[model samples]
Target: MIEGLEPWAQQGLGAATGLAIGLLVGLERGFKLRRQKEGKRVAGVRTFSLLGLGAGLAGVVAETQPIAAAVILLAMLGYLAIAYAPRLTSGGDATSPVAAAVTVVAAFLAGLGNVGLAGAAAAILVFILALKDEIHQFVDRLEERDIHAIARYGIIALAVLPFLPNEEMGPYGAWNPTKLWWVVIIVTGFSFAGYVANRLFGARHGTIATALIGGAYSSTAVTQSLAQRLGQTKGGGAEPAGIALASAVMYLRVIVLVAILANRILLPFVILLAPALIVAWVAGWWLYRQAEPSDAPAPPGNPIALVPALGFVVFIAIAAVAARWAQGQFGEQGIAILLFLMGSMDVDASIVTAGGLPPDLIGAELAAIAIGGTIIANMAVKIGVTLAYARRNGWSAALALLASTLVLAGSIAVAWLRL
Candidate 1:
């Protein structure tokens, strides 16, 4: 907005922005000290406003006389130190003084013509100050495991990711170390997020809600969890519907991941997968209505185990090599078979493998079939998981998933004919 403005106008605008930022901080401070005796208060809205204005004027002079600006800031800080000395002696908290210091810095930045940064900093400071109690309460709720999980993720994302090379290496140049690690990061991140949500909000709702949240990351894990709950309760009927709902969410989640990492094949993939997605939801809804109410499924284990994360990277690396080999050896047919087999255990690995390939290596139709086949195989695996974990009590969950799989199969067939 200031792009075409004259120099004097820009300076004027900067000064105004600084004053506004100061007024905003001062208002919060004033509210906190509203009950204090007027004469005893060290700072107020008017004082802050004047400080902002003075700082802004000093900044204008700094463009031609930088030493003057430094002197002005030092003099202001000196006054603040003298005024706050009594509070320090009385052992009062330093929040107010620290806030005052921030206000000065932010206004100085605004005066230096960084109005956007100054405004943003001032707003965030106010927000943090306002939420002090809530933030403390949230911190109090953090378990040791939660803190460890946070630190682990920080390492995975911030420490490790940036250091990995982006170039494709290994056999057939099929594996890009950076891309493979990113898959692990994204998949692990999703699972960890679901774990956190389930911990915080799962018990408050019930099995269905837990399924909904868990399904976004790993429907298979959700199935196993709910199936175990069903076993303990001997046909706690809600587990079946919850399992189905998680699978439904999985379909949507798959499409979303596809959209994020590989959009070229998205249209055909969605077309073939849409019917299954709808069927899963419809079947889940029906089963949910028929089942008796049940408690929330037990929380799943933390999904961030380092060994498993490293193992997944290995699997993705293998899948990428195998996919490239299959495409070369048997064309689309070989790749389709490879994808189906891989998807039975881990659909995400197949996705990463396929997404990493050159776009022209497989047309959209074949990509849809390969990914759709994985979904079908994954559903079949979940059905087996239900029966294996829940025994006879899991028939409802098995039936619901079977219906969706049948629908998905039919959709795949239709898509095949069009090819």
Candidate 2:
């Protein structure tokens, strides 16, 4: 009898302690709720406190008897409350389930604490609850397209990711779908971050700001978007000045790629590029301010591209082959030439290939230079595309943009070459 009594007393103490913690946290919330009278779809502090206390009591009683029977009884009561909640709650808000979840947690904690677990869970729970509004607002601001991007990420992770063969594929054991997918995930995550930052900080900051954020998504996409948006003119004319100004942001983006791929070399590039970028910004902003209509739509490029999983895989495959061939035939110089050439078609492909090149085959700076050259090649392509696509395709703005791009390219090259 004394042994039994000891276990009961210990269980009872733990149950009481769990109840106290839950009640203290709940009471503070309840007082705040009552004072504000702001209706959320959640039960107040007293309800939470009672739920926790009752759960602890239930757990203590269950230890001596049929655990399954106690669970069944609790389930029936829980179901009844949930079923009745919709009818009982008149101005039913979104938070009611959150409150119910807290009740469930409190019960779980009571049971776990009886087993000597659940250390400081209540404190962590309170901290999470405090940040509820900020979390919700952030999720709410997320664009539908951005949501799709996240879903794509999930598909890549949960679905396509696991099924893919992990071993290297092709002739030289150089390609792995799993590895490529990992890169896709990384790029996708970065793109999503850029998108959110763009939305938050670049909303009204100006086209230059948009380009900076957009470039993070893809500089090509950014260039196309800015050209299209800025070329829409008042009455019957296009705005060359506005488009010119946005190109200033493009120069900065070009310079940025060097920093990303090879930071040690970005000093020379950053110095050279900053002046031209700033000059373009000032000149372009002046022109844009003079020419732009107040009611202009946003640019046309998607800030996020779902991380093109398959495309990245294909890129890796081809680049691996090319990298191997370049190493065999022409050494590091040949690899550099290949990277510089292929980079025009897709900068990512060249970078991936160069990254995998044997250390003896290519120095890091030389590889970076090839990648930087590809960026320059891409700039020329974008400029050519914009000239044809733009409504206000003319000599003056074109010359200025061309000059800016050349300077940006030079900055990247110089950085890659030396200190």
Candidate 3:
């Protein structure tokens, strides 16, 4: 198509690109201003279209006479300021001319070889304008603590992270401050998302919804929380179902993390873990079906507070050092044992350590064994915590959880035997 066009037509095509983008934006603005008194709108479709055309023409002139193009742009800006000067002085229409100013600049850029950027900015601006009500509502719902939590996350991820040294610092060169902080960021970010979701929807949706959302952050925490609720309610069967569902979600979460960080070992890990996930899901679903309906309050507060994020960073660093030392001293078997011990406390830290290990020291087979051990150990911890905390009414839930774990164990045994 370009080959068929004359040189003048080719240049016209470039100008047309700017014109089309301007028209798209102008059309949206025109619709928005449709109900406004005709003269009240600062600029609508026709005004914006002409502005875009002038900008494009200026850009074409810039190729041969840059100074002339500059003057033309300045003239346009001057005209816009004069046009809105009365409104600015009146103070009745406090609406700033910033958006219109930006649109003109975008139009200039669209002509000056930045059409994509101009178009994207215009589109995003339109979207923000359209979502004004929703944005306001979201802000209105945010509590002081929620704002603080967001600031804390920003400090950790943005302020503190970049200053951390990237070089390995301690314990067999296992601790890289930058890398460790990044892991903290990823984990904390994930937990923050779940925390936000629970806040937004958990009250209306109840136990099952809370379980699923909270599970993404820390299934162990969810399990313990739900178990405590069970004790309070005198063995509400639905609480057990929520616990089981959270556990099931944990397995899938591990699979995703492994696939992302240690993809080569994912198949074996999934083979050993997926059956357990399936068993837990089935048990949870059955329990949900058997239970009476009840409201499960939203889990309290953001789980990714600053102190907890720091604690997790310390925990993960310790786990990584321990796994590295163990691997060096007793090889893969040592790693397996350390991972299981660590997993009993925090499966995420254990799995992350296993995934970060050098492939030579921990091949697919060893990583799989270590990961499997951690998972089984974590399951035991969950069961024990439930039984211990919910002592009065958790017996039935513990039994159900134990049964699921046993079924998972059987599947793992079968997998190992086949191997």
Error of 1 at 232 (Å): 2.1
Per-residue lDDT, model 2, residue 409, is 71
Clashes of 2: 1
Q: How accurate is candidate 1 locally (lDDT)?
A: 0.84
Q: 73-135 in candidate 1: lDDT tens per residue?
A: 888778889998999899987887788778888888888888888889999988987877877
For residues 1-419, write the lDDT of model 3, one tens digit per residue.
14676757756765676666567667777886699886888777887777777777776667888998899788878888988888788784433256556666776776666667867876776676667677787788888988988899898789998789989889788898988888888777877888888777776688888888888877788888888788777665578878888888877888887786667789888877776778888888888897777787558557667887889888989888888888779987788778777766777777678777887776676567667777777788889988878886777667767876887678667766665
Worst 10 residues of 2 by lDDT: 233-242
Cα error, residue 301 of model 1, in Å, equals: 1.2
Winner on lDDT (2 vs 3):
3
**TM-score for each candidate, following the candidate numbering:** 0.85, 0.64, 0.82
**Residue-wise lDDT of candidate 2 within 195-261, one digit each (tens)?**
6666655555655556556556565565566556545532222244545555555555545544554
Error of 3 at 51 (Å): 5.2
TM-score of decoy 3 = 0.82
Q: Better model by lDDT, 1 or 3?
A: 1
Worst 10 residues of 3 by lDDT: 92-101
Model 2 lDDT on a 0 to 1 scale: 0.60
